[model samples]
Target: MTEPQCPLHEGAPRNHVLEDQCIRKGPRRGMIVASSKIYKDGSAEVKDRLKDGFAFEKRSCMHCVDPGCVSVCPVTAMRRDPKTGIVTHHPDACIGCRNCTFGCPYNVPQYDFNNTWGGIKKCQMCNQPGVERIDKGLITGCAEACPTGATLFGTRTALLEEARRRMKLQPGDVYKYPMGDVSKPDRWHEKAVPVYHKHIWGEKEAGGTNVMHIGAIPAELLGMPPLGERSAASISETVQHSIYSYMALPAVALAGLSIVIQRNRSQQDDNEGGQS
Candidate 1:
């Protein structure tokens, strides 16, 4: 049997098809763009290319431990599931402030410019109300369609263990990489292991993420920002809690507003009496 081609390589129609599927099935018309990095191959036709070959990675919301998008939203539009850890966006509650776009470290949340009435577009892991794939015991479209076992869907604990197992494997050793779901894979894709970069992206990045990445390429090269272990959300949440403790900030603002209104009324009354 012929091995399934990597969907991430340049000019791979599979990636485009997958993206189209995502856009169609998602709440809005936007795709989960997978970042593809082009490198030189050992081909005479494509000169000045590195012999090491090409590297590519899928990009989307990290579904952070303490998501900055969730923290910055004025309305409670962005919410993380306590049980599943899936971060979901509610269009009805969203004020279209575009705070999620600015606050996200991975630059995941996107505002739909084309549609005048469109809300924030993001990956909710097919767990949104209408789609609710997780609730139905179904995997994401990407994970289900990934023939090469490139995009496995499973619990964090199970995936982490698989990642650790892959990290320890020597390059060129044959291993059966699990396909579809990590916990109960439909089948295994047997292939020789490639040299893996020691670091696992999303393990401790911005206090960690539910969606993780493991690849031969360095994460920075795959367009990941250099982030510390501490999440920005945690810091922002702390400051916000301190300032708004006991509704102190809101109460002070209300008092000031009332004083301004009273002063305005007094001035209006004086002006009316002078005219009389």
Candidate 2:
């Protein structure tokens, strides 16, 4: 039997060659090229790039609007800023209970099990006091680091608009996609937009998220699981509120139980007195 040729061989003179063909070609030789005007003018130039079906995907923070980590943290280590809508954690207060790990739907919270002290760590969007990227008018490391505009950082609303715009583009059209932080000026790349799958992953997953993602592949294929409309944190809060809606409810229940026990004790005391 003959060995298969590498699909990415450069001498094949094609975009992609089969392993059995033993060919080579230049990069993107067969791949569709995007229009340069899209980057220059900020418009969608392509549509229907997907030879296969497409799905919509967006880059978003894994934690939903109301995050499970914020709700289940025993030491109040997990906190969400109302204004920025960023979820952050205080490692000093964290007992390493791993509650956040169990609570998160996306399984984003990671633990440093290898540490001698054994602590938990996860992406806080590089928002430490000195390393505040968003506050400093910069994007997170991942967004800045991404060579392709695959991951973008911006206000939730603006990112949604960009996603919608891309969905409208015809395949093979070039689009100038923003890179780094959307709130501030940063690096940008112009490239042909691939046929998208048609769903923004973070737009409404578990009631939305701050970060968002766009991808050529289906999110499910990338290990992102399906989720319900309501975020896990929202569900937990509703249950807690229902049981403790009113402070008086617990107080009243406690009083009634106490009264019944007291009456039983009094009856027993009377019976003992009579026998004596």
Candidate 3:
């Protein structure tokens, strides 16, 4: 996908959909994004992985139900939509804290270091205002721009069912896979199916994300974050609440310290009396 502008130096890969396992946000030098943007850094990638051993991976947001970025945000700037399960950020409300950059394990959020005024930019799922394409009954821009039906947009339920259906199909068999929105049959275009991976990414990672993926290659090669079923954000928040609930954290710590100090004083007094 073409970025709003070239975030890197004067000449760099403009916009391309990568399915390899390379990290999107690599080490950078100041405002110049000098990270590895190529499909294959060494012998790992460049093109799509076939069914033999190479797996083609799509790099995108996990959109976890309990994203760490959202949890760590000082403000409620990063929030998940209760109904649609879409994670979006509000620029006006954003304080440019960059807590999200550190919070995310996948590093999906892209910061435009070029301009000091720029806020964090990531795939808001085309939910930007005045471009509510999903609300307007159209698929995401990426899905629409996909000429050969590579990228697709649909409900998590529909996509999961589609993935399950594709898994049952035998290799080398000609099956028409839906290109666009799976919910609306009329919007879909048929294409030859590629062998799908047994596992579906985002199904259970970090308590599961709404945007799921099923690829030919391992999910790791595609740059998806390695996460567990329980979301890190959820666990961290739960632990924090348990420790600090009712503002008892400070009180408990103080009480314990006081007891220790009193015991030490008593022991010193007993030693003096015995010596006397």
Model 1 backbone overlap count: 1
Each prediction's TM-score against the native? Answer: 0.74, 0.69, 0.73
Local error of candidate 3 at residue 29 (angstroms): 9.7
Report the C-alpha lDDT of model 2 over 1-276, residue by residue, as the tens digit.
000111111111232221221111211211111100001111323232233332323222354578889999988999998888888778789998989878987665656555688665555666755567667866666566666576667788888888888888887789887776665646778988776778887787888877655655555554466887788888888888887877778899999999999999999999999999
Q: Candidate 3 residues 1-276, lDDT tens each?
A: 323222221122344222222344443322221122223334554233432233333444567788888998898888888877777777878998989878887776666666669777666677666567666776666565554455667888888888788778886577776666766644444545556668887888888887777766556655555788998898889899987786797888999999999999999999999999
After superposing candidate 2 on the true structure, give the runs of residues whose Cα lies further than 4 Å from its correct spot.
1-63, 242-254, 260-276
For model 1, what is the alpha-carbon lDDT of residue 194?
78
Clashing pairs in 3: 19-57, 21-221, 55-217
Q: Mind sharing the TM-score for model 3?
A: 0.73
lDDT of each: 0.72, 0.61, 0.64
lDDT winner: 1
lDDT of 1 by residue, 141-220 (tens): 66776767878899988888989999999988999989889999989989888788787888888999998988776777
Clashes of 3: 3
Supply candidate 3's per-residue lDDT for 135.
66
